[model samples]
Target: MSNASPSVKTPLYAQIGQRIGQMIDAQVFRVGQRLPSLRDLASQNGVSVSTAVQAFHWLEERHLVEARPKAGYFVAPRSRRPALPAVSCPPRHSLALQRKSRTETIAVFQPQGQEVTFGAAYPVVSFGGACPKDPLFFDDDRVRVALARATRIHRHSLIEYSDSPGTQALREAVARRALHLGCQLLADDLIITSSCIHAVGLCLRAVTKPGDVVALESPTHFGFLDLLESLNLRVLEVPTHPKQGLSLPALQLALDTQPIKVVLSVPTLSNPLGAVMKHSDKRALVQMLASRQIPLIEDVVFNDLLAADERRKAAKAFDQDGGVMVCGSFSKTVAPGLRLGWVEAGRWKDSVSMLKRVQGGPTNVVLEQALADLLSQAGYEARMRRLGALMKDRLQEARGLINDSFPRGTRVSDPSAGYTLWVELPGQLDAMALFQRCVAEGITFGPGALFTATDRFRHCLRLSFAGAWTDVERRALARIGELARRQGDAP
Candidate 1:
């Protein structure tokens, strides 16, 4: 055999193209800004001038970057795409919409009109939305193998309806995973749904009726609040802490004062604030709810992304009276497109199952089988380890940037786990107004108002560093700081 190891086939033009592409994406060349001379680029990347020219030509062909005579190459302006249609939801009443007229007005909803999506608590990666960076990060190879096996075993099953309760294998796997979290469950205790949101909807339908009161965390998930409102349920906001999570004393007060029927919270790595409740507190909460017989809807989407030793203990772990209904999903961990989530309804299993059947019949059978296969392949743990490390590093970078770039008096809530950062801006700078400015600059973020029950966090905002590049995050922070300073200095 030759000592030359198969002459590692290197394509010089392709390498040049990739480098230029990255530079454009990094905003090294702004829209309508001229690129450096081909000779300079060749010298910089150590390629021939012709190769650099060829790369620019390829970019032009793809409409990614354009060449201007004497001005050189610049990033092409992206074509504006049509907006997505507004999601049709049934009319309902809640604090968010109750302020508006009671008349059935179909508000023209367009997600594009919203500025700085930091208001929404989705992970911000290149792909955008709440999708994870590596869909197969937790044993992609295994998922593929399992998908193949499932396909062979159940042909045309993809077109058929899934088991009303969900696949036995997947449910068993979920039960096993729940046991690890200190909840004793069997396969029958589970009801699979399309996603955590779906699971929440099912739980809500099972317990509360129209016009009934439900207690929610002060700075809770907006989707949950919206869902409750759509179902015509009255929402009572309970005080919650930024670090300790939902305040038990406040919760008790609310339960005592209001005729609340359901309590919804994310006990682990709570969205926006990223706080995890203590085990003792969880036990107390479980007991408190049990005493009132108030149904608890636990959203644990971020449960699996915990740091190795600090895995949060769930409220379901302490449910001796079976009032806690735990909802979790693989969307945040495995593949969001799969839309696989389950609810462990201790005593409400039957109700939840019936709700699932009524809602949309059943979940996708093929996808569930694929996820089950993915979990069983023994690669899930290693994948999580790598993902956890990446998330930690990214979050640290984000925190450092915020601290260094933000103006004085700005406070940041440091999360022990998860990829979100909740920041309180200085002075009377409104987050919503700041978001509009950010949108004008082609940057997006979550406003703090959406996270709070009252509009008290008007100066705060939430950011996701999960999918953003380090340089992009730095620029965004700097821009935000400048805007904040300007707002503060104004009369």
Candidate 2:
């Protein structure tokens, strides 16, 4: 229905809805902004009130507008352009990664069923849409087919522990996939792991010992901090730009003053902040680290989501001397339940592969084969393109709601790709307190405090829109905004 051109074959009401969608897209009417009343629209377009109602129904179905109780239809928050978050300037020193208690870890997510799992404690808070767990996000039938085929093809492998370096077919598939990231990986060097985190863990073990200082962008994935803490490593968070990503100058300063061992970063479509370092910046970062003999654990997990294919190139693409350890997974972009990932460990290739062989065994041959089958699909790019478009829509609506309901000083990241959003609430708005409140109302998000070892992000939070897009999710976003406003209003 949304794809119908404004031609004669299109229904009149649909044509009206399409026009309104165009207006909303053009920002002639802001998201969360009201539209003409049914009567007003009917009169303006010389259509019946029923026709106007139909037009609004069409708009609502497309997420272009929403109706309020006892009020006429108003434009939905569908604008993806939110005010970008301010640059982050964390303390210039390194500190040991702190492993907070279960209580604190629980605050990172509320009760949810989509992409997250929690401990046996309190009720889960709803992420509205956390991970894309629902079948709506993937071709489940195709996934089942691939899995079945892989099992049939590799049934004999069940009798043995799979090859330590993963199946050659899957590794070759991974190498072929990495070409889009501009990395010509050798399938022989690629080691498939349980997941991306597993690959990163191997890299960390190969390079840094306990108490080693690793520099990364601020307000990063909490999972990284959890890994560092478990490994007994210290974290030096470089000041990061919300849009541009890690500050090279700040990182160079830290390296000059501190004993930084390794730099872990997501140069393209970084997590939480969704920042993408420029191509030149990526090269410069590689050169800068290579000169200092520091290994860069570059994560290209979300690099595929960047709107432009050229921008999707991983930082490892510029690694002249085997200095960048690149890791990635298909869970975010493909079937999450598959639980598979791969890595090219640069200079530490043998060490990482050996670590995987000893510490964590290779991924199941059936799963690897299934993933290989999925990757070999001719329509994979089209599937990702659709997912990318869906993410843009969700991000736009989320930003609109944040603009409409959150406190005035609130700022959110505006990324061209990716499903996660970083929201910086107004002054004195404690995100932890806000999380507690949101949990009560069945709405939850990752508080900024959990993202770092520092207390600097006390007023920020990260939200993901990878879950199913439903009215409940939409209302949850509005409720979160309302609850945040109340936090500031509290005495």
Candidate 3:
């Protein structure tokens, strides 16, 4: 895999460009397919625009891709084809849920109050990774200006506790934004919460009580598992496809067989697998929930990150009987430090609002106003576009690395949007063992066991490509592959 020659070293940009060629040869990208924007390619590969330009030129010279005027590069015609990963098949049973024991915890956490320094867990090019704000995408100055302006302009509202369901201005902003997701909303239906997870928790509390059976995707989000466990709920995990968000038929079967009370899901850009449910499937899921009279707590946090407009549509958009409760936050798509999330509970709006009132008071008016300003600003859409392109590039880069370094039998999910990747190694490879070894080498990753109630995905793991693809981080990923290979080779 070493591309460097004996006499001369290959440039990083050249290597990246060559990787793109390999992808084209392998038919991972098809003929006439548009390439990511030049800036996006640069950001994803951790190179400069000039470097990406050189890379593209190199591809052009080799006849792998051709540039179109005004449009981006596209893959040239080729004969070879590349195979995609297979869909996932989770076990068909409810699992005994347990909390994370101290010993089971991965040793990747730094001491509290320590200033977070990326790639600082080890010396000499460390790779201990955590989900941090990418400077390439987020503009810190813009956020600061918005916060300062809000504090100055809304100083009068700081003295008193606002409405229990959040400020009207912020709700109106959210309602306006929901239109893009194909959701029709009124500000009165929205209730702001501390965070997205908090919004989900509130929705769960509003509908179901302790000991109730809740259905969710197999290999679901770890945070949802923790929330369900904290609420003393049993889990009936429905099988999920890597490409499709959830298996509707399996969920229907579960509904018929199990005493399911509430079904929770992240339909658009689901975590770990990064699955974006098809639009038709979203509508079908909504109707199914309505037919059963079961409420669905749909997490649409990653909806805005989707590339296609139709893909960004919320499951609640198709809910005819108000059976879907949509929850979302600005942390993933917008400002992370704001700690703001909202829920639009259809029929159970009063119940969710009541639960919020009992659990906590109103959200900060100043922060709400600031987020409102940010969301309403014209620059917001442009920022989202840049972010989407950046993530697309990073995903392609990481996937290339995974294919190059991992074992031959390894498979990775190709999500339509978002920064998370679900990797399935060969059967014999234990993700927990790989996680421990990677941690020993000062690299951090999420093992698959953490995301499930059962031991179904012990051979799987999740990686977040949210950060910059610096040399250290890239090397760390390769190092993880090496460690996994060693583990796989063991007797």
Candidate 4:
């Protein structure tokens, strides 16, 4: 909410200066026009005169505004900057998916030192975890209380293994929560798993054997590709729009030609792309899947992060014949440490349950009960609100930086929700090389090649602004932009 960088290390004055810089770049103050007086500016920004003075001085140093004698600073005339990057232009034809060598990816091992990481898609340390960060998002005391209550009440079940289909209380809780996504789920139909991805894997395994083709958004979560690869399933990459989500016509083409056994998608707040399917489009997608008798594994892990209520509706909401299976986890929304996920397998509930039981069995009963308590509590919505606001602020800051600092031809995504940005660098810059360069500078970001089965996002990359956008992260973004510019300049 505040313009302050959230990082204690970044002084309030510096943030104020950055805010003013942004305004200037937008041409808020014309050249030769006197700027607001120091006192008024301070009052406007809720800062002290000293801070305002410091901000103006900082601007003057950059030659953006000049301080005249006795008069306040005036905006300096500057050449017009280039336009932002354009939307992606991937090849029209689908290609056979290939396995990537492990060395191609810069694996995100545990941080060793003060590395500025934008490489991994996970939330930053401040907002890190599958669940909302404790204290900042979810109340730690509340979680502990729920855990204690669950333990006290279900102490006898501690020694016994959990139900293969999961605890009844947790299933009921999940059913209640599904209403928000416009899904009317039965507790009996739900199956609990170790995590959301675990549920997705089960759905994949149940629906298709190895070598069967699966259709997915072209620029999907790298994790999805990893799962598909491990499953030994061939992938048919469908063309996904930056904002509208999977192209239905493109998908229809894939369905007509390829032997796609199932479709795995994150319809709401899709990973990397952050594309949200329109409600009508969602219905159409469900109908199309039903017509083809294909299954949909909808990942609603990031659905709660959408600002608009309409945008949070999952594709499963439109399912009438169990063609859509909803997969979710609390890692991104509630608490990551919980490691709990759920799946409503539609018609394949029995199969998914069997696979889950055979593969990994049930999750911890106490943890499931605790999560149920957390979900049933009133604070979950408020926590999501806080998380969404924080993510929006971080995203806006990052998008602005990318627009201003990145190479002239760099195209960036303006997703409706979530913290990830899909960047298409101009001049055919190799994202892997960019990743290596950033790593050398103690900075890391997700390269484009890692996200797909084919050569779709070779010049693209993904950046997550889910963490605190401190001076270090900001500098890292600028450094990436500089590197991108240099890469574009190279022969």
Order of all candidates by TM-score, from best down to worst? 2, 3, 4, 1
C-alpha TM-scores of all predictions: 0.74, 0.84, 0.82, 0.81
- Model 1, CA-based lDDT: 0.69
Name the regions of candidate 1 deviating beyond 4 angstroms.
1-130, 134-145
What would the per-residue lDDT of candidate 4 be over residues 113-203, giving only the tens digit for each residue?
A: 7565544422222211123332454456666888999999989888987556888899999999888888889999999999999999999
Residue 258's lDDT in candidate 1: 73
Model 1 is weakest, by summed lDDT over 10 consecutive residues, at 101-110
* Cα lDDT tens digits for candidate 2, 103-216: 567644554555443323323445623456645557777778899988898899889865478888989999999999998999999999999988898999999999999999
lDDT (Cα, tens digit) per residue for candidate 1, span 173-278? 8877776577778787888888898899989999988988887775666677668768888887766666777778777777777778898888888877777788
Q: Name every residue pair that clashes in candidate 2.
A: 80-396, 110-124, 110-125, 111-124, 111-125
Q: How many Å off is the CA of 17 in candidate 1?
A: 32
Instruction: Please report the TM-score between candidate 2 and the true structure.
Output: 0.84
> What local distance difference test score does each model get?
0.69, 0.83, 0.79, 0.77
Q: Where in model 2 is the C-alpha error above 4 Å?
A: 1-82, 101-104, 107-125, 128-130
Clashes of 4: 11
Worst 10 residues of 3 by lDDT: 1-10
